[model samples]
Target: MSDNQPSPDTILRLINGYWSTGILGAAAAHDLFTHLEAGADSAAQLARRAQISERGAQTLLDGLVSVGLIDLAGGRYRNTAAASQYLVAGRPADLSALARLKLTHMGNLTALPEVVRAGGPVTDAAVEVADNPHWGQVVPAIAAQSVPAAAVAADVLQLERAGEISILDVGGGSGIYSATWLERNPAARATQLDWEPINAIARRLLAERGLADRFTCIDGDFHTTDFGTGTYDIALYSHIAHQEGPEDNIAVFTRLKDALKPGGALLVVDYVVDDDRAGPAFPLLFASEMLLKSKQGGTWRRADYHAWLTKAGFSDVSFHAAPPATLVIAR
Candidate 1:
């Protein structure tokens, strides 16, 4: 191949991307990183601890090492710093569950070709609601992924400086936002609106964090639910917009605008593409997932958001870059 010509290496990597997913998923399932962090060093030790064949353990370890998630030092295996922090169970910011959860949906991507041709998932309902049975597991994994961005939102809104505040979390899966913000302001209380099943998960999680008293759940569909007028100091529409159509988003934004008390803020956090939609690789590619899963959803442009929020009666709108996601604030 000529130096200036395209390289097959990129295409090869893209085609074999599932190899990494399977490797990460299997390691997470076995709590391999957690074991490594707990001092299980050699493949033999891992095999004994996990009740697996030593050969299997060594193969998995080598795969993890190649993926930069495990470090192999002289006769021992250990989690890399990144893996130790984010792939070990029980860590504060652990994403091990998220890695495992991705495995459950990997097969769904195979439907993408047909889905794209049909312009959406084949079913009448979007895959989001269509997979309600897994919400109990799915929501919390997503909540873990949202931690950093949620903290940034709480800081940007200065929840710590505020007095007693009332928050409305629309589709607040796992109550992560409520927990994060309420932790910052002891006087703050939050109500999350979601399905009863998902609310149950959020309640259990918030209670486990000793936040039960300050958090509440209103189980219902956000589309038709009543968001009482001027009842909230803050309203969150995080990670939900990318799964909705423009009309639905505008309608929800309008309701959120009406739900906010005077001087209140509404925060929307999601993978947002630039106006041209040509770059910002993650958000651009995330659109494909939306196309395969939702009826009329995709990573939308910043301009689209500005227009939607403006149409929804949000007079003041601004955007903030929160790594892994973007925050659009409207008031």
Candidate 2:
């Protein structure tokens, strides 16, 4: 390759890089994209609007321009097309929450070396829900994502055919999955179970959506709580299983199976790795994040889920691909 051309390894590392994390965090915190949304402004004007030092704002603006996140013209700064569309607050595609999530976890990155040295034990001291107020915020955001994911899963499951469908949303914060199902299927009602603080948020969210009348909230630890018995037709364990180890996961699914009526469907939505555990960037990166953040953080394979479902007495196990992840459904 020519000297001017970037090496394949260098390009790969850049593609998978975390180098721009701080810049993204700074932009989010300063609301730079939001400021630019009104129209182009000088760095000094942006600094005043964002309430930051002018010199610092100029430096940041120039950096963003260098990265093609913004455009520079006549000593003024403006959001690039990409940033204007996706990073500006109130825009439909705004990813401010995602950016904030990165900022919140930035401190945890420092512990990764220590975690590797100690075989991942350092994550035991990683920020937990009790330690971080922002942790609760993730529940609602996750709910926004899960509700649709579950709906897709439900559609695939042919939930409308079932009579008197009862759904148990395990670790179902914000009750979005349950709420979505209830909205679509008037014959169906749901029970959302999650931690007390998160469940409180779920209750408020459900009420805001006028879904409190249709959904029930069970506030308790999923691992210890009795999730009721033989009442549910669809049991959903969305985006929670991979946080615990395989044995604990099996236990949870077994509990769900026991709680289900005969021939009931069990829906498991998560970032599933290939059985070979070799590739696909997001899940692998998520598994690494779990390693640095959760006690039992890693992506499980479809085979792993199938094995657990089979062991839990759930039959007709099937897997479906969703963007960024997969759904494992069993009955």
Candidate 2 global CA lDDT score: 0.77
CA-only RMSD, every prediction = 2.0, 4.1
For 1-331, candidate 2 gives per-residue lDDT tens digits of 9999877986864764564676777878889889888863887778889999988787778768767898877766788887877688765446666776677666667777887776565634535553457657676544444544666776887766655677888888767777667767777788888777777887887688687887888877788999778988888888887888999999999999989988788888899988898856688778877767676667988889999889988878988887576888888
The alpha-carbon lDDT assigned to residue 91 of candidate 1 equals 73
Against the true structure, what is each candidate's TM-score?
A: 0.93, 0.80
What are the runs in model 1 whose C-alpha is more than 4 Å off?
A: 1-6, 73-75, 124-131
Strongest candidate by lDDT: 1
Worst lDDT run of 10 residues, candidate 1, spans 123-132
Estimate, for each residue in 272-310, the C-alpha lDDT of model 1 and write its tens digit: 988988867889989988887777888999999999999
